[model samples]
Target: MQEWWRSAVIYQVYPRSYQDSDGDGIGDLAGITSRLDHIAALGVDCIWLSPIFASPQADMGYDVSDYLAVDPIFGNLAAFDTLITEAHARGLKVITDQVLSHTSDKHEWFQQSRKDRDNDKADWYVWADPLPDGSPPTNWHSHFGGPAWEFDPGRGQYYLHHFLASQPDLNYHNPDVVDAILETCKFWLDRGLDGFRLDTVNYFFHDHELRSNPPAQTRPQVMATDLYGMQKNIYNKTRPENLGFLERLRTLTNQYKDIMMVGEVGEMGNRSIEIMGEYTAGEHRLHMAYSFAMLGPDFNAEHFRNCIEGFQRGAPDGHPYWSFSNHDVPRQVSRWAEHSVSEDAMARLSCAMLMSFEGTIGIYQGEELGQTETEMEFEELTDPPAIRYWPNVKGRDGCRTPMVWEKDQPNAGFSTGKPWLPVKAPQAAKAVDQQTDDGIMAFYKEMIAYRKNSPVLSRGKTTFIDQPEPILAFTRKADAEAMTFVFNLSKDTQEIPMQAEAEIAKGNFAQIKDGTLTLEGNGYVYLSHTGKAPI
Candidate 1:
């Protein structure tokens, strides 16, 4: 059977900010179900939901207390089932966020593990004896801030947490822990979940020797709030043992037909591409993997080329899921604003470029409307990293503000009550109703339709062309179908001599004149050496 996810276009829905049915200021599963039409109309194949599992909301549901139960804030299990049923009815597969690396400190297992050294679940979490001076076991730092180890008075030892102290990392070294998490995965799969977006896939295990990480070879010009990036982080995450667990996950998902698992590789720079290759290199591991490489502030032609070509070189068989924006990072428009003439132009260009890539693609909620990040004051922050580092580091709340659906309605029709995060005028101005005839929205719909109708853009292999600065060029080929794609990455016009054999196949916002392809700022075109264009 054909794997449906290979060329699939997925839409990500941050449940808490998507829609609210109860008017309680938080979005719910029922509200998501009500908005299924919006996603279906985008011509996407699947919906990847951020975690809606039971949690303390310490890290906004990244700290899962019960993997099997739905959080009441997002509605109950019945509502979740209805959502699955409704999404499937609309031909949309559901991929849920699985926070397998850690659990809320309030979890029953964590509660049991912390009580004593020999409880039934005592080895379920990564607990270590304190140093001679009662300091943390290692010098590893948390991703959020502070040491990665937390002290447990009852057990007379320290437990590891790569994130918040309220969320403890699971001991994947223990067979029982692995078995339990696998069972949790099966529980959801048996309930008709299409697949999982494995959160922090590389942080499944820490070094058994509790070694300290070496200092980073280089530092950023801007000192980040957490010095976690100041070290190489070898001791804490991306251990070789992670591969075995992923294989186990693959084995479990294999029992169900066409079930896909896309892992999130939480590394930075070129190492991220290397790890993405390792995790998804073969049929026995993750179906696909994504990294923070594209989600960061890099928007140049060389950076994009290196990431894609690097993946091809590392994992010849591995598949990648490319997404420019998600709930975790700031939205793309704001991050790459300096390179574009206007926010709307950048938004349209992003959709075109991402869809043209050769792998699975994801569209974050509100991106289609050309939504910019909502600027927030320190008091309005919810993300942990931003809260700790205040003025210097703005948290994810800026990009995670409520999705705007209506311009005239209260709270932009996202909720009947006040939203958890305010919808500022800049974002509210781009609301769905107001963008009905908006150029950016229409361009997105057109681009998505064009990608779906063209085989080369969806499944073809890529070969990049060497071009001047601000001009990115590549050719995608699948069997007899071959198409060349070119884009102007800056806010200035660029001209490239067209290949003698190349002809305009299907294009947008670009023109061909005097044997040279003229691309206005943020313009793109697709060329083919065939008969009349189909799109």
Candidate 2:
């Protein structure tokens, strides 16, 4: 069998917002199974479910209470089995989020580990003794807010929590902890799971010596938190020991047929790209990995080029996963609004740009409709980070709102009852049922189909074409076929000289009539050109 995931188009499904079948306002497993047809119709290769494991709903299922049990609110184990069966029946691979870096504070392992020093699970989590004055072991800060350590009075020590205090970092330093996590993973594989989307994969291990991280060489302007951004984060995560564990995880996956895993390198800025390279450098680590480099608000051609080229140089042996939006970040349409002509045009451009990138691509649900982030209020917020840092940090709740299916239906046909996240006028207007042939939905379908059919798009090596700002150009060549792709990144029309004997393979707002190409705002063109790489 071929390595399907190497070039597959993945669709991400946020369980809480996709659909609700029980009329309880919350989405469940049955809801996902019922919606399989909608997903299959999109021509995607796989469906990536974001964290459905049993949890206390803290950090929205990123903190696992039980790896073996499916949360009752979502459904039982039987429902999950049916989801896998139905998804497979439609020729779609099913993968799930494996939050291995941490577990819910309520997890049996963490509970027992916190109870006493001599318990069997005492060393399962990263626990450190308080400093002389009774403070945290080191000066690490949590991603959410406050200190990364929580004082457990009973254990007389502090435990490391990279994210929320409820989500304690697992002690990969312990061989037994690694063994147990692997067993948990094996259970799913035995159940016929296609793969996993590893959450915070780099945070699996921490500094054994408990050293303080040095200050960041330059405080980046994009930092949301106060102290977390100031430090370079050398000690608390992305430890070298994590590489050995990934090899172990990869070996376990290799035992199964056609199984693939994509890890999310949790670091930001350039370092994230570096981590992705190390994590997927060879056959021994992750099959592929993604970094937040592309997820941020960098909209220019140089930023995009630097990220892809950086990864190529850093991990020539590794594969990359590309995406513009996900559950954690603000929707792309809204984040990059200033640079686009319209939401629909922005959606189309992002989709086309992502398709041209030289890596496996992922498209989040609702992106087809050009769904913008929901405008939330303080009272309506349920996200931990949003609630903690109001105004300053708008948080991620805006992007987790319910999917819109029917324009006129209550809760946009996502549920019969009031939805967990509201469907406001902005998103409801872009409902799936209301879209026409000329709408964003149809544009996305066309682009996805084209990418799938063209070998140049799926298996091409990209060479960057130098151009002025607002004009992003590149060429993808594979075997005997070569194609030129150019995207207009701003709201103003841009013109650039072109050289190639070609016909328009596909595109909009672009035409080569006089040895020069003109691209309108948010426009793109794909050319089936002859000769060497287009410049």
Candidate 3:
């Protein structure tokens, strides 16, 4: 089968916010099917839907109660079939989110497992004996805001939950659990689904010994809200066993044609890249992997360079999926506001930079429209993290706001009724209908077209140029075609001396005059060159 995903641009759709066909203040599969034209117009090759599986809505469908069934809130199996068909018709592959790491406490397997220690499904989840004093298990901490272990009086044991207490981590140590998950994957594949976006892929397994993770050498003050980050996270997740499970997943996916699996490496710093490398090292593992490395607050040349370079050095054969914004984090336009001249400039620059990178690219919904994160009051929030952390964390609700389609329509045309998340003035201002001739949207369409036309940007090898602060420069060289990409990541104008036999692309922002390249604030340029000197 062809490795189509290698250069494919994936558009991530957060179901609850994309479009709501019904007036339930939520988005559904049918709503997504209706908006397929917008995604098709953006020239994306695939659509990665966030979790829409049956759930108790504890973690917004991340807590899966039924892996094979679609949540009623997002329509049923019939609706999902229609979505797959419509997406395929638009020449776009459909990849749904697969939260394999854990399931909702309301799931039948979990219900059974928690009923009794000697039940048939007793080992279906990660259950451990409490300490002698009746305290919970080891020092493992949940990513949400509490201990990783949740006590169940019925089973008289503590169950491991990397996220919410309601979202219990499955025991991958059991072969049955692995087999069952594979079967669930097969169910979707049989339904004409292209592939899956494995959620928190690194957290699939935990140390059998139940060992406590050691403290990190240094805890960054930036992520202080997440106490889980204070530790090295050695024993809790990204265990060696994950590779075997991934291989098993790869083996299963191999049975299908052109099927791909992109695992989400939910780690930070160099370790995240390392895990991405390991998980995608070869054909036997994941087709590609992505991490939160670029989703953080750091917005500099060195940071971006390190992430791409680190992946290349760590896993030369491994593939990577890069995205600046997603459902979990704040919008890039808002997150990188300090470095941006304006939100529009940042949006255009982001597209230029992400498309020029040599890997699979992902664009979250509303990004093409230059949507900024919506500010919401405490009562307006739906995300658990935001509700718990409140003022300090402000969780993912801002980014997960409704997709604004029309400025005049109700709820920005996302829904006829009230939206689950508010569409405030800042976000509604960039509505799709209003942005027909918008610079950011036009740049996105043009840049995506440019990227698809040039194989070098997608398949070439990346070579970074050592330049001063604020300027990021790199050359992407394929067999015969080579292109140099330069960006001013800061709000200040910068000029760099470049000696190259290159012609500037017409639609690009920056220009080269008198052998000197000048980049305005948040400006970027693409240079096509057959021969090159210093870049």
Candidate 4:
């Protein structure tokens, strides 16, 4: 099998927000097909699209109703075939989101599973009887809110749902369920998909004993998105059985050439590294896995060091994928709002840091133009979680707003009608057309092209330099050429002490001539060693 995914830069496209060719206030496959030129021009290796499967849009396509069919909201199967063909013609691989951990309540399997206990698919979903007191079998909490178990009146039993009740968790312990999911995946693989971005990869299995999760030993006061994180969530998710399933998934995909799978592990802090390590430890499992380590609000030198170094220690032989932004989280620029760098500078610095690392990188759409989170009012919200937990949480709708294409155009060229989520003025200001001349968009194109052309940036081994707070320094060396990357995470200027012989190679910093390399607040510089490179 060709390992083309490694050293490749992937661009994530949220289908519902990428572009609306029909002016239906939602993006479709045709819209994505029309925009392939823009993605190819950006020089991305592959495009990872969010769910386009038939869905009720309960979780914005995360709750898939049909695995083998395309939703009319996005387009028909013909549109998908055209998209894959067009992307391949542009020399770009295509990947789609695969939500195999669970399916929508409307899915046929789940529907039959909830009909009665003696049904052929009774054991398809995780169903259990209530306790003596008529309470849920376990004290598990849903990601959205309330209990993870929902009672079905027809079956007189409670079924587990890690997310909203509209999504019911599949029983991986059931061999038949595994066979069905594998078949569903084969359906897509037969259609020539390059790979799949597995959603909630760690949540594929649960403890079969239905044990209650122990409470988290420590609890810091947090009001962010309810009390979902208050517990350890050991039994609720991240079970050992998930690894077995992942191995099987890998076995299925490995049958095809150049096919890869990247799992999204949502574990936080140090545990995230452990999960990533275990998932991608060998060739028989996931090709690559990513954690929330780089997607959070922590931007300090220690946080950055801890994340990368932790991954290095945990996954010594494993390949990891690093990303800064996605459809679920707020834009990195706004999340790290304390850093006072301009949007243009920050975008370049972010791309440099990600591409400089020793692994595959994922870039969210509109990030090339330095887009920020949309400032949305509560009234315009369509996200269920945001509406449910209003005032305290801003929900994900702000980050998942329609992509802005043309500046000074209606809806910023996202839609002819009102967008699903209102686009903010600040974000629209950085639209694609406005920055085409000489700004962040152009810089992004140049940087990506450079990453593709340069051997050190594209495929090299990384070495970290132990520096103080707010300053991150690393080196990527391939063959005889070694490039040192230094970053300033703070809003204040910081000086990186380097030898007099170090020569600046390619970066956006201003002070590179002096031995004391100066980075003006969130600035970064790349240097090529004129002397012997640091071992």
Candidate 5:
């Protein structure tokens, strides 16, 4: 089978926020199955569903208790099978989030591991002896807050947990543990899953010596609400032993024809790009990897250029998947509001910019509708991080609100009952029911189609042209086909020297005359230099 993921576009669906068929105020598999046509119509090749495995809902299904079973809230195994069949029938491959770095403390393995040190599962989790003062094993801190080590009274030691105490990090140092993890993956592949999106792929290992990480010069990807980034995390994650486990996983996936795995590199800043390269540098590793580099607050052309160029310079043969918005971060339109003329313009510009990049593309649910972050009160917050650090952190509940499908219905037609997270007026106003022919949703459809049909944009090599700030220019070429893409990532009109001029194949708010390319605020243009123009 061909590497279908090399040029595929994946639509990410946060199942809990998508639809609720059982009126339980939470989205489920049946609800997602009912909405297959909506995803198929988006012109994307694959569907990436967030974690739906049997979890205790401690961290919204990411804290898994059973890797092989579907949670009751999402549906049973039979419902998942039906969803796979429906999605495949529509020529769409299905992938699910695999949270392998940790498991819920309620899991049988963890439960047994904590019972006695002589059990078969005793070494299944990362446990260490407390320091001289009976404190945590090290100076490590959890991504949520406080110490990364949680003391278990029965075990007489501290077990490592990168997130909440409910979610305990697995011990990849044990080969038996790796074997067990691969079996769960084999079970999913046998059920006809096309691929997997590995959540926090780089977090699968830790230094066994328990060396304390040094302090950092700059905490790039942290907020003041957490102290996890106060020191550079060298010992806790990104261990060299991680490659062996990834290779073992790749070997397992290779057994099933056409199965691919895209990992989520759990890092930030330029270092994230370097890790992405290493993880996807060879065929024996991940098929592709993505990080939170582009998901942050940077909106300038230099930042975008450096990210793309850094990935290329780090690993020439590696592959990357770029995304603008997801459940964890604020929406792109709302996050970069100061750089665009309006919400609609920013949405359109983001779509055009993301599609023009060279790699597999992912768009989160409701992003096509230009959905902004839903402001939530402390009482309405359920995310563990936000609830713990209320006023300062302002948790991720705002980004994880339910998707809006109707304008005037209760809960915006997302649910007959009150949603898990309230769907306010600002979000409901951009409902699917109220979309116009030239609306943001339509532009997403157009831009996605434009990318799907263009080989240069998908399979071509990129060469960026140096320009001033807020002016991003690049050329993609494959065979006789070539195209130049330029975007004015600012609120003011700007002009640049036209490197090459062709017909405006697809895009808006730009013009070309007298060797000058003029772009209005948030303007973009697709200059096709080949006979085969964009659709």
Candidate 6:
């Protein structure tokens, strides 16, 4: 039988910004437990929380110091256990972000690995020697900036870090490291966790030869960042050995009943889809995988269709998880402002389109309220990339602002003290209290309910219907119903032609005579069959 994730909608919750029960400025496990009703009301089948493990917060929680202990900044392990128990009691599955590609320098394993060579844990991390000129061993650059190699004075050698220098990449070639990670998975699975969202799954392995990466043959598909783009990134990441480790992780997850694993592949463009295909191709690997393809600023009809169809073409039987916004990039409503009729319309339309896709869906916190990216100043920056790149890259902290529940509440009920990031008036104005009815929040709730009740949408085969540019058209067919979805992705009005017998079924659509339908700028229509439906 197909798993629940095959047709489920998972919500991504950035714990630091979700809510604060202790008024500590940072969101915590108790904060999430209090907001369970808000998430359950959205009709999402599961909740995927970002890292909450023990960390120094150098890269926020991405640099995990302890794999098993919950960070005191977030909460204790008891708090996490209560969160899981309460979330399950409310009928919501919980998945957490797992950073397996690397460990924080403060991690015990890395600490020991850096304490000279020839120790028991010395081979746990990827460390190499410098060149004759005392330069980095390879030409590969870090995802953040500078060379991927960091010189550790303790070991008198360079350690590889695909991202920040503090986040040393793990050496998965060591069987003991693999076994330790699998045991960590068992720790969570034993605690009744539904699954994990593996962070940087493709970076789990690197070429053992430590070869220099080749330069890009074509203009790299740059995603608003120049770092790690000019090179082909062949030798540093996405090694073939990574597949065997994924199979091992999958084998561990399969021991539990209905446990699922979804990996985050960090490659750009269609390569992300290719990795998703490979990682989830068989039952021995991940149950599903997601990429940054839709999280960026691309919003045309062709781009949307290509992302979904690309995955389908790559792995016909593999499952996929889709999201437009996360803790990483700018909110979709603001990122796609060029194509929005208005922020309100864009948020509603985006929710509709995401739910109509052929895979599991994830709605990041505050996305339901149509949250816009906070315009933060240099002084307000907490992200290292933003601090380093300054004006060039605004950084991800803008989109990672605190969630606003009430307009009048302090910090929008996210905290009692000052929030980690300032809560702006523009964002507070669009809070949940102001969005009670006939608002984007309401539209999100209704759309999620609509997906649950509609058979064609919930359990149907998607068939692409050819349409013009900036207008995506597709049909979903089930046992007894067939539904057609159409959208205008531009700021200008477009005329949609359909069969005379086709009736407007979902959303507000004004039909015209002689098979001509007019859709206002960014308007969408979800129609059902009134005549013989084509399967």
* C-alpha TM-score for every candidate: 0.97, 0.98, 0.98, 0.97, 0.98, 0.97
lDDT of 3 at 247: 93
In candidate 5, stretches whose alpha carbon ends up further than 4 angstroms from where it belongs are 220-222, 530-535
Better of 1 and 4 by lDDT: 1
Local accuracy of candidate 4 as per-residue lDDT tens digits, 127-219: 999999999999998888889999988988899998899999999999999999999999999999999999999998889999998777686
Q: Which one wins by TM-score: 2 or 4?
A: 2
What TM-score does candidate 6 reach? 0.97
* RMSD for each of the candidates: 2.0, 1.1, 1.3, 1.5, 2.0, 1.6
**Superposed model 4: Cα runs more than 4 Å off:** 530-535
- Runs of candidate 6 exceeding 4 Å displacement: 220-225, 509-512, 530-535
lDDT of 5 by residue, 60-159 (tens): 9999999999999999999999999999999999999999999999999999999989999999999999899999878988988889999999989999
Candidate 2 residue spans exceeding 4 A from truth: 220-224
After superposition, candidate 3 runs with Cα above 4 Å error: 220-224, 506-509
For model 3, how does the per-residue alpha-carbon lDDT over 113-159 read when each residue is reduced to its tens digit? Answer: 98898988999999998999998778988888879999899988999
Q: What is the lDDT of candidate 4?
A: 0.87
Model 1 spans > 4 angstroms off = 531-535
Q: Write the per-residue lDDT of candidate 2 for residues 7-68, one digit (tens) a residue.
A: 89999999999999999999999999999999998899999999998999988899899999
Question: What's the CA error at residue 74 for candidate 5, in Å?
Answer: 0.8
